[model samples]
Target: MQNQESEQVVRHPFGKFTYLLCSILTLLVGTAFMGSSRVSVMLFCLLFSTVLLTAVVSVCHRHKTLGIGLTLVVLMLILNVSSFLTRSYSLTVLHNSLVIIFLAFVFYHILSAVFHDDRVTLDTIIGTVSLYLLAGLLWSYLYSTILLVDPAAFRYDLVNAASEAVTLRNSDLQPLIYLSFVTMATLGYGDIVPVSGPAQTACYLQAVFGQFYFAILVSRLVAMYISAATHKNQQHAQGS
Candidate 1:
């Protein structure tokens, strides 16, 4: 087992960080460039960068080899290329990028916890953060589908396809996105109002879950710290 583990190779933190930085820059450039005449070319580049970055992060999980990670990533890339050929690439690329972002966020927390300390305390902290991030992603996906995709069918222009408009100006939907993120972190920024039925319910539930998740993490950390302190105290008393 040890020999096999040794034989398996992985990307170091520096390499992963480099990939992430480049990928983020490419994504930003792509987004900015899309509003111009060269939108298709920019978007294609963006998708390519996203796939590359996702593969890098996924491989860092250490649960698999680089070869395995490359295989999965290449398969995803192939699908993306197919989408482009079939002319449904835009939506497919968007969906794939979202999924990759979620995966990268998760792996980042795991990497932070592992390298920072072998202690279970860090794991708890990372786990706590992951819950909120997941909630935010979920809300964003739903909002994108309901408003941006089919505003007329939904009978609301909560968030239209375009970001520049009066309906978006002073809109409550931005607050929902903020609330979704904040509530997940137990921040509970009360400024955002969820007037709609589904939005209100989702916000409330996410807030509850976020608080509960944090409470659990705090309790576990406290217990572990107290146990370690007590043990040391007893040892000192015996020595004295």
Candidate 2:
């Protein structure tokens, strides 16, 4: 019986390993090498799509909806590659939209897995963290789309090392991604400000969602842990 239980645990799909890989890849693409050359950006896009596709397969492989997930992943891959090659605005928008959808799907599955069982394991903890990071990435894509549509959406106080003001396009992804994370964390560093009404609304919404997600996720995990402990103690007492 113990061996069977261990096997079951070992065979669990979409666990800590997958979530950790996704999170690492997301951080690498989103922050570490952003604003690099075109080749680097293309590489990032390709790797990011692969990560998302891996996640979808991991989560949906056992379900009847795997076909749908696979289809989306393929479409996303194609769009991402095409956007990298062409750099067309329409393709970029479509690619961002697909990314958002894929991330949302993965987030939903991770959340479901985290709270599915009474026990809280390492996988659950890692999955929760992944969800948070995924939310930031999702918002970064949204911000990117907004900037692409309206180059004047955001106002950045670009100051050089010499404290000289410089001009930059809002369409540049590095700054928008930085802004997205800052807004998500409610940092309000004031270096990048959302000047347009739509931009302001989106930033404020992201801040509010970030705070609420943190609070709710923490509370849910704590509750699950406590419940699991209580159940285990009850079983111990009953055995005794």
Candidate 3:
């Protein structure tokens, strides 16, 4: 009976955050090294975002939502790819903005699922990791969007270290992608410094948010474990 119960919990759609975590990881790692074509980068993001979004929709148990999400994602993918090929800044900015919306949507669902559950199961721990990845991805999209609007917003390094910036359809959006995660981890490598005020503000905020998330999540897990153990012990004592 205990084994069956554990299996049931594992089988729960909302508890299966491992898939979401893997999908996001693939996106992050793949985009970082997927060669020199921005079209390839956008396509890679398209593939994984579709998969991750579908997973979230399954957890939602709403076929209608999945249908709508699929349609919207696909439509954006086509437009974004075209924008990249045509070198259209407006379309590129629109794509990044839409990506942020989808990331936030998944973040909300996974966070609610992980925190509302009283049990500290393996899936719950995995969901927490998924949330962290989603947070980094969210910030990356925002950074990229800001850079899109104003190239000078970020001080470019791969350039002459001054008065030079990268285009959206070149290689990896590494300047922003790398900086986003490093800032979230609070590493502050200083390789890709944000010269503008908005960029500076985003860096500090993400750093603080990352640290608080780690501290709060660890404490919550520990408290839940203690409570479960104490409740089990009390039941055993009463039986004796």
Candidate 4:
């Protein structure tokens, strides 16, 4: 029996993060290099928000959250369309805010799943990575919103193509997304610096949060891995 068991290869099942992470990478890489134009940025947000909302909710498989996601997606579509037709800044901001909420919602649910697991599985590890990425995305939305409200919040090379009315057109969304991830990793690449008081505060707070999250998650994963191994050993002894 032992030899037969040793001969069989163990396969790990794909977890919640597997497909969702794939979608995120695909969308981020595919849309990031599309263009720096305002229209392209908005289109990227639309596609990404829809994909994120749809993908995250699939993990819980809850009908209620699924319904809520569908509603948000519809509203997002409507708002995007209206913003284009009427050229309303309020509609645009509202759309971005809703996307932020969707991200927070997903982050909360994923964390809940991580805590609920007793054993350290592949999904749990992937969940941790997903949480980290989701956090960066959430902060990216916040930074974008702040930039929209205050053009001078961040001082970066703004003459990328014809993006003179930077805040109004939201051509800096991609740059802010880059800033978000960089800040979270505490890279401090001064290519784009936050000048305003609010922006500076946000950057520092994100740096701290990112560090705490990494330390805590690593400990949690280690503890769970040990517990799982111990439990397996007990079961083996009992079977003997």
Candidate 2: TM-score?
0.84
- Regions of candidate 1 where Cα sits further than 4 Å from its true position: 1-135, 148-165, 168-177, 185-197
Backbone clash total for model 1 is 0
Between candidates 2 and 4, the one scoring higher on TM-score is 2
Alpha-carbon shift of residue 215 in model 3 (angstroms)? 3.0
lDDT of 3 at 28: 76
Those runs of model 4 whose alpha carbons end farther than 4 Å from true positions after fitting are 1-13, 42-46, 157-169, 234-240
How many pairs collide in each candidate, listed in order? 0, 0, 0, 0
* Per-residue accuracy of model 4 over 79-162 as CA lDDT, tens digit each: 777876687889878977987887887888888888999888888888888788778878887887777788788877445477
Residue 171 in model 2: shift from native, Å? Answer: 5.7
In model 4, how large is the Cα lDDT of residue 125? Answer: 85
Write the residue-wise lDDT of candidate 1 on 1-240 in tens digits: 876665663322233344444454454344433432344644654555473555356335665545555555666566555655575635554555554454554455544553454344533454434334444545644543334333332222344368643332111233334545676776754544455566556667767866775576556666667887888899999999
Candidate 3 lDDT by residue in tens digits, 122-195:
88888888888778878887888777666677765555467575444222465567887899999987777787
User: What TM-score against the true fold does each predicted structure earn?
Assistant: 0.48, 0.84, 0.81, 0.82
Model 3, poorest ten-residue lDDT window?
A: 165-174
The weakest ten consecutive residues by lDDT in model 4 span: 165-174
Measured with C-alpha atoms, the lDDT of residue 91 in candidate 1 is 53
Best TM-score among the predictions, by candidate number? 2
Better of 2 and 3 by TM-score: 2
